[model samples]
Target: MGYYAKELEALLRAGRFRRPIMADPEKLDMASNDYLGLAYKRKLLRRAFERVAAYPWHAPKSSLFLGGYHPIHRDFEEALKEANGFAAATLFGSGFLANLGLIEALVRRGDTLFIDESYHASGMVATKLVRGEVVLFAHNDPRDLLEKLADHPTKGRRILAVEGVYSMEGDRLKREFFEIAEWFDMVMVVDEAHSNGVLGPNLLGVFDHYGITPAPRHIKMGTLGKAYGSYGAYVMGSEETIAFLNNRAKSQIYATAPSLLDVALAHEGFDYVAKKRKKLRKKIAKLQKCGVSCGYPEPEGLIVPVPMPGIEEAVACREALAREGFEVGAIRPPTVARPMLRVILRTPLEARHYRELFAHISEWRDGV
Candidate 1:
């Protein structure tokens, strides 16, 4: 216990302590996951919330297996399932819980789990709880994943996990990843937290980005928080897959279901995104013109990672930018493999905002 305490102290001393900050209306906000900016639109959000205003505050306080489950949840699940072409769908409290519950239930002691090296922290945590063989492949590299599969060559239950749109790097998955998983007869689990409302004709996710139909063997976990600007997540898969998780996924079975208001907001948010996608894309295109260039892969979504090279330099750049009234994401080790500025774009941002951001990055890069 003392050893862990000391380690935490060291992290704090090194400016790596994790702390939360309440959202400030006056701040030039850029550090949020509100890709679509619906959360910031008061009138829109209020109107959406009004649809469920009749529901009581403490309506959904019980776990799904208990009294928490509601007809609204079932209706939302069915709607999302039909829209996304899944055999069945189940909702959870959040993206983290969705990934934790689904992944833990799928990968057991006798199974093999292959995850992307750059997978989200929540998914990584879920992997730790699995009593199975866990292998990490190079980020977004299908060839390396193929090599790993060849090395393991498991005929038993196997899972290949990836993110549809990488949260930190903003990279998108290619069709090749799906092909590789299918070739090996492995279950493909895609966490589309960042990509859910940013991709597809109707924001259906990665399959829309790639212009392909969803494979039956694919298990998709998507969040309502990021682009959807709501407070829950959902897992879509075959009826059998969903049924198994409903019975076995500990997080979902034990955790309280989302409130009726939250579910209502998510349903409305989905419709909002679908209606405003074209306009949102225009805003994204404008924001993409901001900031300094990086060597990372081109973004397939709204996240724009501006590289700062090292921890000290990244911290300095973030601070300097903050002083200019822009609250950009100051990313560092542990959350990512290396230090870089995580700049998430929103549909409400203007060209002037990006121009200021670009100016700051130029100043930092020039060391002036």
Candidate 2:
């Protein structure tokens, strides 16, 4: 207790210890990534239960890529393509591996990589592996990328990586940046982890909302864990790119594949959200009506990261919220230093629920 006391005390003092609130089916939920309430949907659960029950005793004997490939796995990939209308896609056990594997597989020795300054932590780690020149551009500013690419030599494959919709900011990528990647003849790779089932009317993802389809060199990565209400991720790209990743990506080649049950559960979730996203939009509007300002802005996406000026204040705020039964966490350095507090919005976050949460928030004087 003594050894852990300092960390725990600090978090409590600052208001950052996120109480793992047990989901009270009876209580109105305002905090979660289940944007469309797909996880709780009876239809998806029935499918998931059936699949899991089918394999009651044990998992499949072999890896899906080798001799272990199952019909369900192929079906999941097909469902993903059908949902997003991409040329091809391949699933990963999780988003971390998908982002890390894709970047390391594409960017090589002589290439240059330009990434958004506020990109995900996985991207930052992926940069360390590639023996290429890594340059940081101001977040979401195409102008910086334009200047950097113009100044840079027409070297080996240049790739511009960014989040399709920023996780913390809850903001969508500006359309102007697409032309920047095209002008430089760079590969445009975007991580759509946070937007898979929360952005568009049906959560068809970023492209669906913006109507910007990917060209040959463009690629999009998404996760089923966050808003999709399941586990695993996928990278959507050209057929050649998908093949290259399948054959060349070490993470894919060496790692064990996702469980059959996991894939089935994920597919059920995707299908559930596809049918329910439009109705969920009204719930999102109700959340904003409660005076809980989105960190970025409204009607953009589901994330609502509040930029707390200071770490202590951000930490304190999370603590205060949790004490009142709101399980919000204070996002700080390493996660999102720019925005100290990230407000993640999902469906079922009603106006009255936020009012109750805010009422508790108003009681706090200052954060730790």
Q: All models: lDDT?
A: 0.81, 0.73
lDDT of 2 by residue, 193-294 (tens): 866765666667677767777787889898877776677888888899999999867777777777677778888887767676676656766664554441
Looking at model 1, residue 53 earns an lDDT score of 65
Candidate 2 regions off by >4 Å?
Answer: 1-31, 52-60, 292-299, 362-368
Question: Model 2 reaches what TM-score against the true structure?
Answer: 0.86
lDDT (Cα) of model 2: 0.73
lDDT for 30 in candidate 2 is: 52
Query: Once superposed on the true structure, which residue ranges of model 1 sit more than 4 Å away at CA?
Result: 1-5, 55-58, 290-298
Tens digits of lDDT, candidate 1, 134-166: 999999999998889889866568899999999
For all candidates, the clash counts are: 0, 4
TM-score for every candidate vs. truth?
0.92, 0.86
Which pairs clash inside model 2? 14-315, 14-316, 15-315, 15-319
